[model samples]
Target: MSCFENIAVEDIQSCINAEVPSGISEVNMNYAVHADIATFPVPLAIGAVGYTYAKANVIEEDIAFTAGKGFGKIKVQVNTGELTFDGVGSVGNMKQKSSLSFFIPSNDAQLLGFIRTRLNTPMVFAVPERQGQNRLLGDKFNPAYISEVKGTTGKTGEDDKGVQFTVSSFAIPLIYNGVIQEPAIIP
Candidate 1:
């Protein structure tokens, strides 16, 4: 059996929520937040065959990507110096240090809650078929699923240690929260 079977959807949702830091401000001007459940450590193994013992330990980092127009101008305060904007853009290549937040609706929240309730249950991360310009499909083509549970498991004890999990690519999807009074326009 695979270790993924031990994980529930709710566990993944909790990991997503836990990934979001506290005291952060949600995008309330003209944007919304949408989250999807992600699977890591593909082709997982629970020790050996016929054993209740499973290693479900994982680490998830906060994922914050830029959205909307003028997202590059978003400012974030850091100690004595404040990080300001040098340009206006989305989650692509831009130089700005802003801590923006996204919100979820009650229905999505309920769904996430339900997913969380299924942690430690037998589960498997599905690998979808790839056939387009979409990077997600390309990722699905790769069978390696790096778990974020450890920051140093795959790295050598050196100064050049790298991250274990694959970095999520950026996508510009329109988010709707029914909270924005108007759309944010960049000039």
Candidate 2:
């Protein structure tokens, strides 16, 4: 029997009359060690929504945070934040590589030093979009790591000066349907 024969088939088209917006409005980041998140949703192969991956649309449970621990919020500027996915190999050995990139408008020494410590830390991020469902970028099984951090203080006064971070993972982003909580920070 052919491998295709065992796969479920269904319509995978989107709504033609619906409108979709663009851009991420906010990012909620937290250390993976301080939280527990559910795995990505998987399609039920033998169910009626098998081909459509209905259950993969949204996660219903919230991420469990350690006592007194919560996500750190970052407000993204227009056109400054985005998520990209690249397939690393062909179908037989394919892997989904997802990356989240965002710019921080500040380049303070203290903040720079704090971010520097995250080089080896695994993290999970929640990206809230302008007009769509919130997206969760990493989980316990497939955590995200800060691959790059670039801090710049531009020469010209009009030029942008800030830090850009690139977070990478081996999983696809999923719709998050839980409340995002952030702890108060003492200044």
Candidate 3:
């Protein structure tokens, strides 16, 4: 005999009208991956890795909206906050200040390899955005170097699995050229 109760239909896909917003798919996060070694405290190898700013995780993005109480108050716009994105990475490799115990800093292969060497080290602070959506979200802010280093030995829980690395860096806006990255809203 089957030892089971009634089977409920799961993973359902429904269609909505144009006015209604579609369900969320997945959020894409972007981190600073650079080719240089000067960004760090110690001398990283020729293959420094770019730290993953976030995981398939949660970021505490706080935004408040207010209206202007004047004679010509018509709409509500973002009057405060220059837009921010902060959270923990599953790896916990990036910190606000410089660290001495991290493995990547000591190991040349780890330092100058993979994510570290491939990430774009910006000159200033900014959020990543797609090339097409820059109009509404503003111009390409370029993921510049805005205090995206320095980290501590955080927990190893990991994102989408457990919890661990907490972000020491500040959140920046995402200005992509085509695809939308993490810490952003396309809908």
TM-scores of the models, in the order given? 0.15, 0.80, 0.21
lDDT of 3 by residue, 64-140 (tens): 11221111101111121123344445564542221111112222343334326433333212122222122111112
Off by over 4 Å in 1: 1-107, 132-187
Kindly report which residue pairs in candidate 2 clash with one another.
none
User: Best candidate per lDDT, number?
Assistant: 2
Which wins on TM-score, candidate 2 or candidate 3?
Answer: 2
lDDT of 2 at 23: 73
Root-mean-square deviation of Cα positions for candidate 2 versus the true structure, in angstroms: 3.5
lDDT of 1 by residue, 1-187 (tens): 8546654443322454454332323221211122121322222234434333222221122223234322112121221111111333565655322222212222334434433542222211111111111011111122212112112223355432222222111211111111111225543
Q: Name the lDDT value of residue 108 in candidate 2.
A: 81
Q: What TM-score does prediction 3 earn? A: 0.21
**In model 3, how large is the Cα lDDT of residue 56?**
12
Q: Could you tell me which 10 consecutive residues in candidate 1 have the lowest summed lDDT? A: 129-138
Query: Which one wins by lDDT: 1 or 3?
Result: 3
In angstroms, how far off is 125's CA in candidate 2?
A: 0.5
